[model samples]
Target: MSIQLGSNQEPPKQERSAETRRQLLDAAADELLDGGFARFTTHGVARRAGISRGAQQHHFPHKHRLVTAAVHHLAERSLQQLEGITSDGSLNSTRRVLDALFEQYAGPLFAAMLDLSLAARADEQLRDAVQREEHTVNRMIDEWAHRRLTGCDDAPADFDELFAMAISTVRGVAVLRLLGHSQESVQRQWKYTRDQLLRLLVENRS
Candidate 1:
């Protein structure tokens, strides 16, 4: 759920700074989504953000900083949506949240993250940043599952591994779908994976 802070008043200077940062990150996300891994530049982002290059550098002195911030920014948004999805002890709630998670992985969020992931495989500096961000994201999801999904907190040690595997399988399926896999094949595999996870979730709660 969203929590609004402060009075319902006009924009303060600090709020304006926050808004500028948000706009820059959002523009970076759009650029990354459209341009893929190689097309992100501070100048391009500045142009897209309708701000000066000096302003961009003020917020992000380096390209890596910009990209890293953008990734974290987008991730927070995705996680917020994930956090908002309601779940109780029920199997149906588990299934719905799982489906929501799948959608989170299938969209531009996934696309942007995949770009960094691929780059990280070869670039050590980028790899370090990516890993750090990934750890944060994973930890957030793990906590979210344990807290929001009733049976998860009481699950065994293997629950982490099982849940992680479910996520990896979804990523694999997403890649295959991108490579022109049949829709029927994609749906079949998705069902099998999702159902397996859901079953495990329910069984563990029993």
Candidate 2:
């Protein structure tokens, strides 16, 4: 019989721990996206992350914190992408940047946020947490929009209003996918809006 030494196993490396944390957050994001709060489960997330239940708990002692952290993780990643894209003074580049920003609203992070938002409508503590996270995200996006609008020649006096409207339209378009709208239909509307918005920006008009 071979005897295993109990003390021989090495503890997980710092890099490994961070990786596991990321995996758990990603799994939580997916869980929130797929079924919102109704289907969220600590065990389910742990399994999805390929980690043991204890391991998950060790990383996130509370489930709510984990969910919030998952949103934070996604926000951080989006900010990185936002920073990477250069703002060349061209209408096409502007469109690309806008598309990327809109993508963050349409992607898995947004789904997870929708889950949190719905839950927060009734839960006070959760609502507070979600609001704080949302405020952080909104602040970042606010700066991003302002940055994109800068250095463009002859921007309209109502440029702020126009930008707000455009953001709202893109966000609504994102929600349409959740309402079972076909991609073809969504794409059609999106393209029309894209073209018109591109022109407005390129022309620097309302």
Best prediction by TM-score: 1
Which lDDT tens digits does candidate 2 get at residues 1-206? 99786986766799789888999998887777777877888999999999999999999988778878878877877788787775644787778877886677777777778778988898888898898998888778767866875556677777777778777787888787656689889778777887787776665543
RMSD of 2: 5.0
Model 1 residue runs over 4 Å out of place are 1-12, 151-165, 168-172, 178-180, 203-206
lDDT of 1 by residue, 1-206 (tens): 99777687679889888999999999987888889769888899999999999888998998887888787788788888887777765778878777776676666776777778888798888888888887777676656765666554566557667767766776677666655678789778888888888877666667
Count of clashes, each model: 0, 0
How far is 13's C-alpha from truth in model 1 (Å)? 3.3
In model 2, residue pairs whose N, Cα or C atoms come closer than 3 Å (at least 3 residues apart or on different chains), thus clashing, are none
What stretches of model 2 exceed 4 Å from their correct place? 1-16, 81-84, 151-161
Best by lDDT: 2
